[model samples]
Target chain A: MNFIYDPVPWVINWLTQLLLGWGLPINLVNTLLYLVGAVLICLGAMLFTTMLIWAERKIGGRFQDRLGPNRVGPWGIFQSIADMLKIFTKEYINPVGIDKIPFNLAPILAVAAVLAIWAVIPFSETVFGANINVALLFIIAIGGLGEMAIILAGFGSNNKYALLGAFRAVAQLISYEVPMVIVLLIPVMFSGSMGLNEIVQAQKIPFIIYAPVACVIFFICSIAENGRAPFDLIEADSELVAGYNIEYSGLKFGMFFVADFLHAFTSAIVFTTIFLGGWQGPGVEQMPVLGGAYMLIKTLVVYFLMLAIRFTLPRFRIDQMMALNWKILTPLALVTLLVTALVDKSIPHEMTLVRIGALVIVNVLLWLLADRMITAYRKRNPIQVVTGKARPLARPEILPVVEKEAAQ
Target chain B: MTGMQILFLITSAVVLFSSIMSVTAKRMIHSALWFVLALLGVAVVFAMLEASFFAVVQVLVYVGAIAILIIFATMLTRRALEDKGDQFNRATLVTLVIVSIIFAGLVVSLKSWAPLQNLTSPLSAEQLNVGVLGLALTAPDGFTLPFEVTSILLLAALIGAIYVAYERKEKKK
Candidate 1:
């Protein structure tokens, strides 16, 4: 609509005009523009990633009641820049006995995986990389590349600890992916299209308001996917001693580090686009910069919440992580998807308010019930908070069947 | 040749090369990785055919799930990680001949079918009806029987996997 206001498309148009003016063929010009667009998107994502790392650290420090990165440039805005410089100077160590090819390939592929997802991300009304119809599926496929990177990093290192980390990555990532995919289906169903732009446009009321359970499931699963704290068992610093990237050092290690931070931030943006009314704030269409601004704010809000969760919650035992995914989140997501789809189908599309209210009520009730049940269970079977050990029963009552078996 | 035709040839070459490498890689894990490459190449071919849905699904299911599972299985097996054993057995030559015969027969069969050999019919992507596809999958009087049966089959497989993995505890009297 407001084509003149949209910077990205405007730039593309201007660039194409300039190239055509220079006597370049139309087909060649189109291809050149495509390459230029891809390069711009990749560079933009990488540049944004530096800020995300700085913001994450700054926000983290504030949350933890400490000043972070104050020594660098003003408020440490240049902290990531400094870190980037340091990483470049660091030696790229190839550990003895490590597979050279996969070892080298892993980190680059990891960063590439994150960069590739930008292809389908709808930044504003007129700005996107590919505008793929099956953006969600495209995301899931790209996720495989990330997991493959972890596997390669772990295996190529030839370290048992790294191998264990890789195993955890596969287990946790794949398990969490199931619930994430299921919850993702709600947005697709609501939008009636798999395209991210369509999903964003479909949000008359944000999907989060309509189905908070899916959003929560998506957030939790996404946290696991990113291997952030609580679900950070894959690279549990306390346990695995840097996990899969233990053997990696210097710039290669930095790539993995950057990829991890970028992935979490990218997912936050994805969350914003899908569940929040991303760039849906007033004057966004008329002013494309405003759309980008709205997008950033929404992403930062989610990113802040994610950091709040990461710093607060303790890491999950691998068993607990699996149990949470398979036993609780997967079933919950499936039921939510089914119920919402059924309830949604019966309602007329124009009655969005009613549909949203119905779904919200259902979700809120479930949340309350789950909370109460958890609290009840906690009270009935109290555990020592300090030791994290279960309290013994006051009465030593045994099952008769067990007693009979013991006697036999 | 057209750019698309050149792209298609490159994709096919990758697929063929990777499939051969998948069977030939000494380490089982390496073989699995090669298999992943083959699957990805096939997915690219699907994309070339303008079937974005299947291309995405192929990568999601085959590369993401199956290839990983294969690698995971190999890791679980003894010495499969750095396996140095010969990938082929004593009957390699006989088996190779048999496989080659089958491949030639398939090529002959495909060439005989003019309708199947024609490549221009699906040049452009059809305006896909995802709703109809979804309905056909789950709706009665469609593919519901096979869909329901597949669910049951998956449930059976799940139970079988769990049963295999389960360690025996105390016996019931």
Candidate 2:
């Protein structure tokens, strides 16, 4: 293979030879290489967050009819860097009565939990940190760590508002995870494996075509999981100042901020990997490096779509959010998974066209049926609109009486 | 000692220490967090054993769901937070005796087992593939019955929980 086309293996080979030449043991060299790979992935993800923040702000500004940070540098690209430096220098305010260990550990765990999901994602044919067989489950499992971090931050802060925000966040996260996991089963069922790389390779045609309902549910659930807009009650500004990180300041606070931005983009990357045929395009086989480009392009598209949704939609009420997940998304995802599994088994794998057609038709029909049911339910039990005549304006005579009573 | 053995010993130590702290911690939340650490240590042990499926599942179900629920429940009960009562109660001595007897019995019984006497080689990567585990769980000739029964039990428990939590609304008639 050409060095330019697949530099990762070439670099690995060169390193292996160099380490051997230096007379290091095989096991030690392997361990060192693994550590290097992990550190690189972590650094790459953190650095990428800066760009994500800049892009999100610019897009969000456009959506709100304003110019984003333009003075920092060309297109305000250096804005996040400036913010990073300022945050680095800011003082960490330790609130009184705070639990020292959990408080200090929370931000690190928050960022680490998000970064851990990157370990299994396959950016290209040859580029992945790990090819663990249970990658899909690994993703969900890591999410638990994120939840723990939030709980720790809130509890450690010893602030009532922060605790309340954390409760709301945990509730939303746990509830949404139900549908997300169920939808995830659809892709796994289609690919017959949970390894992300194998899933990517299995996608001769993107799984989304075969399971659009699952795709949509997964997308919505991921957005909710990230606490993005429309499902962002976790950090409701009017209700809780800044949610779980309300008492955190400086770099601790910055870590949480970075986690949030990085998580949004990471979810986008995951969505692309699972649904949009990650790194799979024309000419990818001939030049595997181009697969990385394809992956990035697909991820950006999904990221932009998420940003659009975030900017356009209003946040859901807490009750509405829970109801949507439990009453709607969960049941719908279950049905989709069941239908997809049964249909997939009965059809012969050789007839690709027939299988796809059957799946698409079933998915469309299922969506239509769900829509009709919801519409009928709404008609049967219409939202109560309590209307009454406007109250009469207060008279001057009444106002005087009220003033006299108050004085008394 | 080999690196793997050393790592295993360290993990076991952590697990033991965390489990002790989980029970002995003064604060309920601290106890719960310690419990989580213990669970995570067990997950690490599972990972080291090459049982990636079990390792991930342990973290997902135990650490992710069960531990969080326990912590959430403890938080909801305000009294639990301030509880500074003695960790040991009136029945501590009796419980300790029973636990020790059980531990001794387990050790004696397990020591005589043939499998424990013979050290088997670790499974190859192919043999450890998750697909094999999945097939064994779902195949008709395999563990289908027990698997289905476990799912049913979980479903029943879930429904019972919802029933207990459900609020009844009185009629306005």
Candidate 3:
């Protein structure tokens, strides 16, 4: 079976033995290995973020059916790096009438929250940065902090547009977080654990095969939670200019940009773990270190698939977005949770077929129920104006005349 | 000192400094910021205690949610940033004296206490990943009650937050 081993440790061990021949302690060698791992992960996350930015633009373009960022490097690979350099050297404008303290501190907090979530994630069984018991909860909790930073950035800017965008972003974030948490409960229920590593290990048959409804809910909520396309109403360029980051420029903007991409990447990896059978592939079990390689490849595949969806889907309106969560996703997640609980508790753990059948029944029921709710909602609240005793619809041009009449 | 002891001292110092500054800061926002630092220090202490989940939740809820909420409330309720507030009064002196007494009492008590005996050995990667934690949370006789209770608590918090933050829609229609 293929197993993952952190190469740094093996290298360090060899080096330590060689150094012990020259009289050095093993503890120092171990510490050095840890430091190296930390540095590598940090640099790796940064590089990954940079690459994702380029990948997103290119993928987004192809979905829009056009070429994107082709000039910076071969296939626009270096585009994000070039953009980073430009941002770093750009003029740092501290606009007047802004709260200087919170204004400056917001970006740092934003990036810090994103990076913090990465610490507990098990990239591989052997390569977890810190395999905390509550890895899942920690990821969610730390991820939530980014909203506060955005809100602070908006309010501290003293710009009216920025404040409006900030509040909207906060509303969007806090509202969607509920369904996201509820959806995450599915894996936790099925696996009967909250730990991320536990969740991954529970996917022997893949939770997606059992809790497909929850998988769909989790994926959609994740997109909205991360503020990506379609659900990216928080940072809607056409509507809110640049949303919360409108007033920010230079490296401050860079930090927000990088943080946003990192959030997306992390979300992608997380979805892979919960729904897509993380790190498990055919024939990958037999090779050493290739297990981790397979896991990474799977994560990247999930990431690219997310990018594909981003490019392909049209952005939902804020009202439509919330309706999808509340009316559609939330109810579906509830059913999935109920079914998983029932299957785990009632059916024999050995009876895979029965469990699978029950799960399928639950998902099918949810889909039909969702369709019914939509149709019923449509019937109850028709788009066309009803005739009985309704106030006359105001004409756009005549509204000014009516206002003048009121004043008179 | 052992590594854990040094870490405990550092984190405690940070928590103490931040708590003091949180009350004493001149600006309201500064006080809120200091409170975030203090809460984060508490999270680190939780991590040191091997309660990783609690540590993450502490940061997620307190630093991420409550602190931001405080800053938002301060900004919304106040006008332009104002002058420094009084740092200390007679009540503060009394509180400080009581705090020091409690601290000294705790220190004296801890001097005679034995270190906690380790029960479980350090878990292997395979065991740590899904085995032990999974068995604990499930398995009928394990932590199912605690798990469900936490969910209930989370639900209560969510509903309470929504109710507290709710505003009535304007009656224009």
Candidate 4:
């Protein structure tokens, strides 16, 4: 087991023994060591986010054929640091008539929720934060905090536009989450364990190879949750004027932006952990530090995929987003979950190749069916026309034009 | 008090206080926010009890779904937009009386249970984990009856919601 070879737990064990050897109290030593570990994880995530901001902008810039930010430092690698300095010095804005408590609380709450999700993510075999038995549920629960932040920010701002934007974004969020959670059940059923480490260990075969449909559904829904282009209606800058966080300014706005960027990468990391074989690579078990490197590389690849999707797609109309969730993704995810569960049940646990093959066939069929159904549904009832209706040009409406001209 | 007991007391206090404030807050939205806080405190209390599954479930179902529902409903009602308004009627005494009666009954029932006399040791993590919870939920002769019934109830609720939202088309002809 990689757990046996992983050095993090061994290091912690060694530290505790060192403390005990030095005559420090046992419970206190254990508690202090845990605190340090948790703090280090938080720092790690934050530090990663700092670089991620630069990397994403660079990727986005290249995609758009721009120079990106080459001014600050070499290739603008220090752009995030410079941006942080600037945002730190900018004046904060409160704008009178806002609800004080929720207004102030929203930004921090948004960042904190994303931070909390890291508690369960297994970086390597023995390098998890909480590793709780119900880590999957814990992630879902922690997600509520982000939703609450959006609602509070919109309502607390006392702006009509903000409130309307909040309504739209929250609706989008809650609707998409239904499929996201349902899709999550596929992997949980496959592993038969909810602890993230257990899920990783169970994936001797990466889950994406087994349940591609669920992975695709999860990816789409997570993109909505992360709120980037296409699903980025929350900050649809052109129409809604920055949506729910419109009233926020300066560091407060910066906090929300940081959280947004963090969440995108976090979702990517989670996708790596769940769908790809996390930290599972050649020489990882022999040299456990390689596991961390493997995990990082996989996460960056998935995150780059997210960035590509974000930069490529056009924004979705609100109604189309809702229809996609309700009419398509939700039903597809539910069917996938059911089929996967059945496959898991019928196969002996030892028959790995046979089980994967069964799941893949079921997923392919369901994918084809879902695609056909969507195309057929669209043929029957296309999207409602948004622009003003056009009268028949040859009119038959020429009579109305002549009558209006005569009256004038 | 021990550290665990102290943590328990703090979380309980948070739940109790936030719940009272949730009922008393003037704005409906603010009240909903307070209700969320109270739910989170209850989740913390569950964690303190070493019921991590229940703790997360409480947050997932209540804080995520139910509280969001309440807020959405409040947003739907135009009256909930106002910060200052008459939120309740003059029959405060009647509600107080009804509430006290229920509280007293609960106290009396709890006092009668012998197992409640002393706190038992916390269950091992494995015993209280998702495996046990899953078995307890779906195993035959266990909670399977209630489990299946709940699923049916949820389906009924979904159908009812769809029915309510169905719009009839009046033919232009």
Candidate achieving the largest TM-score: 2
Question: lDDT winner among the candidates?
Answer: 2
Task: After the best TM-score superposition of candidate 2, give how far the Cα of residue A254 lies from its true spot, in angstroms.
Answer: 0.5
- DockQ of candidate 1 against the true complex: 0.57
Question: What is model 2's C-alpha RMSD?
Answer: 4.2
lDDT of 4: 0.88
Task: Rate residue A280 of model 3 by lDDT.
Answer: 59
State the lDDT of candidate 2 residue by residue for B73-153, as single tens digits: 998876775788788889999999999999999999999999999878998988889889888999999999999999999
RMSD of 3: 6.8
Candidate 3 TM-score, C-alpha based? 0.81
Candidate 2: where is the Cα deviation over 4 Å?
A384-408, B171-173
Residue A102 lDDT (model 4) = 88
Instruction: Name the 10 consecutive residues with the lowest summed lDDT in model 1 chain A.
Output: A391-400
TM-score of 4: 0.93
Model 1 C-alpha lDDT per residue in residues A1-408, reported as the tens digit of each score: 235577777777888899999999999999988898898888987888899888888888988898878878899999999999999999888888898878999999899999888889888777777777799989988998899899989989989899998888888899999999999998998889898888888775788888898899999988899999988888787778879999999999999998999999989988999999777778875687677788889998999999999987888787768867886788778878888888888888788678778878888877776577557755765754557567665433644676757766
Per-residue alpha-carbon lDDT of candidate 4 for residues A1-408, written as tens digits (9 for 90 to 100):
333566687788888889999998888897899899889988988888889999999999998889888998899999999998899999888878999998999999999999999889988766778878888878878888788888889988989889888888888888988999999988898888888899898887799999999999999999999888889888877788879999998899988989999999999889999999898888866777777888999998999999999888898988788889999999999999888888879999788889878888998999999999899999999877778777667444466877768766
Report lDDT (CA) for all predictions: 0.86, 0.92, 0.78, 0.88
Off by over 4 Å in 3: A1-9, A15-23, A97-101, A237-239, A382-408, B80-173
lDDT of 4 by residue, B20-69 (tens): 98888898888898999999998898888888889999999998889989
DockQ-derived CAPRI band for the predicted complex in model 2: medium
TM-scores of the candidates are 0.91, 0.95, 0.81, 0.93
Runs of candidate 1 exceeding 4 Å displacement: A1-4, A372-408, B122-126, B138-142, B166-173
**A-chain TM-score per prediction?**
0.90, 0.94, 0.86, 0.91
lDDT for B80 (candidate 3): 27
